[model samples]
Target chain A: MRRADRLDRLQSALDAGGYLRLKDAARLLGVSEMTVRRDIASCDGRFAYLGGYIAGGLESAGGMGYILDRERDAHIEMKRTACDSAATLLKPGETVFIDCGTTTTHLASRIPADSQITVVCYAMNIAEIVCKKPGLRVVMLGGLYHASSASFSSPESLEMLRGIGINTAFISAGGVHESLGISCSNFHEVEIKQTAIANAVTKALVVDSSKFDQVKPAFFAKLNSFDFLCCDDGIDPARAERLAAAGVRIMLP
Target chain B: MRRADRLDRLQSALDAGGYLRLKDAARLLGVSEMTVRRDIASCDGRFAYLGGYIAGGLESAGGMGYILDRERDAHIEMKRTACDSAATLLKPGETVFIDCGTTTTHLASRIPADSQITVVCYAMNIAEIVCKKPGLRVVMLGGLYHASSASFSSPESLEMLRGIGINTAFISAGGVHESLGISCSNFHEVEIKQTAIANAVTKALVVDSSKFDQVKPAFFAKLNSFDFLCCDDGIDPARAERLAAAGVRIMLP
Candidate 1:
């Protein structure tokens, strides 16, 4: 087979399976492991120990492909849509506090560059986008930086929030229940979100419809604390009405 | 003497010296322990068991006075001068990465409002300033948040940094030895500084003159890693020449 055809097949295999080990790629491609290594070298691929042959110089393509693949799934698209719809509430020339989460990150990209606002965020990925915007001011709160989410959250974040009042806050909960309110999986995140809400004039909760009814361990604030709830149209109308009755303005997209 | 004046004297005595027990304050003010407690209550002050009177919310006038008195002997002026000098390096429309330190906090205040730039930082105080800026982009790296210095640093910061490069990096070092290179007090900070250097085209070392001879436990990088050294005029001429000879351009203000 032509080298290009072999590479194409390898790419297909990687894209399909999310990852390809050295030995597995060799067997699938009908090539020696040395040949596979040479191919990786020729392509300037990154080979991590556990995470095999990550495409090099792809800008955003080097991570474990499962994350990227999962991000592109239909279910995730709904979450992204909900996050995008929520981004519209942010006004120009205001300071916004953003917490860390995959859903909140989607909202970060939707924030207009011309809005000319300041963003205070704990998520590193969101901060990177906010930093790229010439008109936006980005503030990163310092605290224990969590490796999993690439964000900082701890008692220090709470203390820092106490020093400044925010115009608006965008937060995501792992689980949302009518009575239990917003719940998170991590205690430190709960503390950070609680403090962020305490310091904000307006609070918006951005969660996908699927996340409803699934309760996480740590209970943060009540649902009533949020001024607005932005979710996908997949949410049941009856549930939406219940939240609306509790004084949350629901926006479905 | 008037009750207020007597109370003021008692407070001063407590402030000027070590932690004063309740009995000490009472004896110094020539009042009963109950009277001292009443005075504390009148001022809305609460005492700790061992930590002394956890100072209450004093109005700006009293708070400023108290802070000034307490921090006077600290590196107040050195920190201020370092901040002033570091602020000069920032131009409008530049994304700058500031490491965590008292000196770097000084630089945070100098960022211009009208100038459009994203400030990516791990320091909580710096993020607060970015949030307040009318026109600046602030991106914060997420990692384990450390309480001592109010900053975040971890492997997560390294991974996030690998994806994007910054225009410039302003890093602080605990120790700047002529031979041993730039070092820090902690490994986490060293990792952060190393990552910041890798992600930035230009690296500027923001150090006070007093830090020239100091030595810390963790070494981040060599002295040659920095393109420019921003320090106050207090830096010794001999040492400056040595740094210059070592290919680090010095910026003294």
Candidate 2:
């Protein structure tokens, strides 16, 4: 198909549905997924490729919070791989705390719809997804809501978190630097993450390969604090070795 | 325009956008809103006019939980009036606990986007709306999620709610019989409602007139327990007098 025709088809699909999956778009356009990706990339902010889906022209993409959705879309495959690896650690009949972030959201998605487990989360997106599964019981940590991240937190909520006994807490961070330690963008999340880490029997830090060697505003914990680091196979060999040497067990999907 | 033509236009618009406002639909069809309503009402479930918006032929209506959405759509105008009255009781900087119900969800929507206040809620639908307002602080009570209602509850969460100081709690119920007392469908919500009513300085029951003199399972509190009953003028004069005589101050919007 001609480039113009493909673009027209993509635009119309977006207009009709507000969003379309890349694979679905590929099938519709009679082209490969890569070609569809290229088509979206070629456009200048006219459309957005969000978490394996192509959303209509910017301003908004239905609900799901556009900012979080956009961030979730970036490096989605790697995040999915990391989450797939992280999900294996979850055993049925166990309580797990899933943190707020694009990475942990992916992990929440990877949880089986029919699995019998209890999920504890602080983010709306995570709760929204997991609450639909009949077999999974969801516990949401409620506090003051921060819109930028679609998360809720407070001093009281943090205290509430300290009381819950979690088997495994899958924490996500904006930065995971060896020397600088781990951090995230929101300060409110700092105490909640720290509390969840402290309470959980096993603490697993779930992040994509892209977060390595980066640091953000709020420092939560040290990289060596986590029992396992779940990520994709995209980590550099030297960096992997350094992390291993630092006593961080890395789990790849 | 012909009925067939109006139906075609409505169907095509729904196909393109999934949902459209009733006013917008009327404008598009170049007819009165009542005509559009009649057209939709005449159809045998071909489309759904939900909360002033016409959703595409059902199965799903793009999240918002189809069940809750359908219930909310029923008697939406009355619910809006009740919520509008309930919102007036909210003063800046006051902490209010909004309960989990379609009526209270309407109340949450009526809250100004730029208002400065603290909102404590246990329902996802309420949190999703109030959290977006930057000036307002939202505290979510997390617990075992009931997907049927999109609300969370637990014994621990009820304990957590007891600790928070709420100026006013706008509660909703499935049934509000004069003699039978108040009740809801889910038994899990019983303790939470009782706790919030017990904690708040002012207990406000916000429900449409349709809920008056009805009874359901899981009784929580008596009708006289509420300081104010917010509803529309659609309420029967005798019923209103009976409630007022029972020491319940009815607030109409």
Candidate 3:
């Protein structure tokens, strides 16, 4: 295959799969593992090899906020399914904190248009879409702007979040594990997520099944920090049982 | 042309022209004025007859915030040139206010990438772009979200704006005239603008030639309210002199 075609195929796979295992990617692309390795670097620093797979912008794992666009499109049905379950928690006149994530955007969108509520979020995408929901007030946290996440998350954003009362805080995590706890890839997000959890009356972690049984660099909250977990049905029954026994309710959809 | 095609054409004209004078639009669309009138209603409430032209969502003129999208695209080179001149006024380490307008967005974009300054804006578009500039602090005013303008502007937004001290205020006006002064179409914007002018150390009005020689419904400030006016070169020499003579330095770009 041509070099350009191989690189294009690699991006498609990475975007859809979020992570590309070298051997699997080679087979999928009908190229040798060596070719995959050589061509993968062409993605610049967007993908980084970790253990067995190449992850999307592993460098971004440091601190820059950007929507994991490809991973977002990957498990649409699962994200929506989890979001649908999350939507049931929303009540009229309640204030909510929506963390920036694909699953969370779906959760915000699932709110019925007629319901009256106040949403405080730092993400531009969440703020923009949530504003259209009828009878709702949107307060976009002001601070340092991160275009990738389309939200504000900094010391100032955290300061603004501190002043408000959140009835429910739906947190997004890079990894959710029974023992390792809830974690994220970026270091900068740790403080804000911690603040949101600490300030809210009720805390819940929203993630797809894919994030289960994994660990990320920056640990924000423990599994016990959330009152419950809302996820897709793909999660292992045993793991779900362990979390449920520990105290957090496992909500599957 | 098909009905959809004609409607699309009408929208393009309205978007480009802000308000499309029926006779001129009919000539451009190669249709009779009667046909133009008949088809315009099909746009639902997106466009309406205002005096002799079809205006964008005449209902919104009451107060809702929106960008005159197509009209901003209408005078790109002129807007950029005006923005370039405005950029010269930005000083490193000083905080500034950029009102929600394409002209102002251009002004934000034209700021030197390496300049160390703080920007407080209500528009998402401006925030998204300005955040990318190096050594800059971007503070998006939090309040009611308006998708049309991609910014926050409300009672809460005004309160937030009042708390900050801006070294320079780059105001976007709907119309600028010698006698009528600075005015805007929406009533909700007047007080916030008035507050900005009052709180700002230095204020300058930014608009293109199209906005000159007219008066909008809601007047916010007088000719002497601004220290200067940044406008396109197309503004007539006589009017420029009148504004200049009235304590507002006229910058033609």
Higher-ranked by DockQ: 1 or 2: 2
lDDT of 2 at A246: 86
Q: State every prediction's TM-score relative to the real structure.
A: 0.46, 0.72, 0.64
Q: Which sections of candidate 2 miss by over 4 Å?
A: A1-66, A69-73, B1-66, B69-73
lDDT of 3 by residue, A1-253 (tens): 5986566445433321135567877887788888878877765654555444554322221122233434533775577667756777899889888887555767776665567788887765465456645467777876556544445654545667777899999888888877777888766677888888999998888888888878988899888988978888988888888888889887776
Candidate 2 lDDT by residue in tens digits, A1-253 = 5886577546533432235667878987788999988888887565655557665533221133456445643775677778878988999888899998766766775666567888888886676557655678878887667766678776666766777899999999999988989999999898889999999999999999999888899999998899999999999989989889988888997
The residue-by-residue lDDT of candidate 1 on B40-126, one tens digit each, is 667553222222332211111111223333433365456556656666778888878888765675576567667887777775435
Report the lDDT of model 2 for residue A55.
Answer: 57
- Predicted complexes: DockQ each: 0.02, 0.14, 0.10
Looking at candidate 1, what is the lDDT of residue A182? 83
lDDT of 2 at B90: 89
Report the Cα interface RMSD of each model, rounded to 1 decimal.
24.7, 11.9, 16.6
Q: Model 2: number of clashes?
A: 2
Sliding window of 10 residues with minimal summed lDDT for model 3 chain B? B57-66
Candidate 1 chain B lowest-lDDT run of ten: B54-63
lDDT of 2 by residue, B117-216 (tens): 7888888767755765557878888766777667887665777788889999999988889998998988888888899999999999998889877888
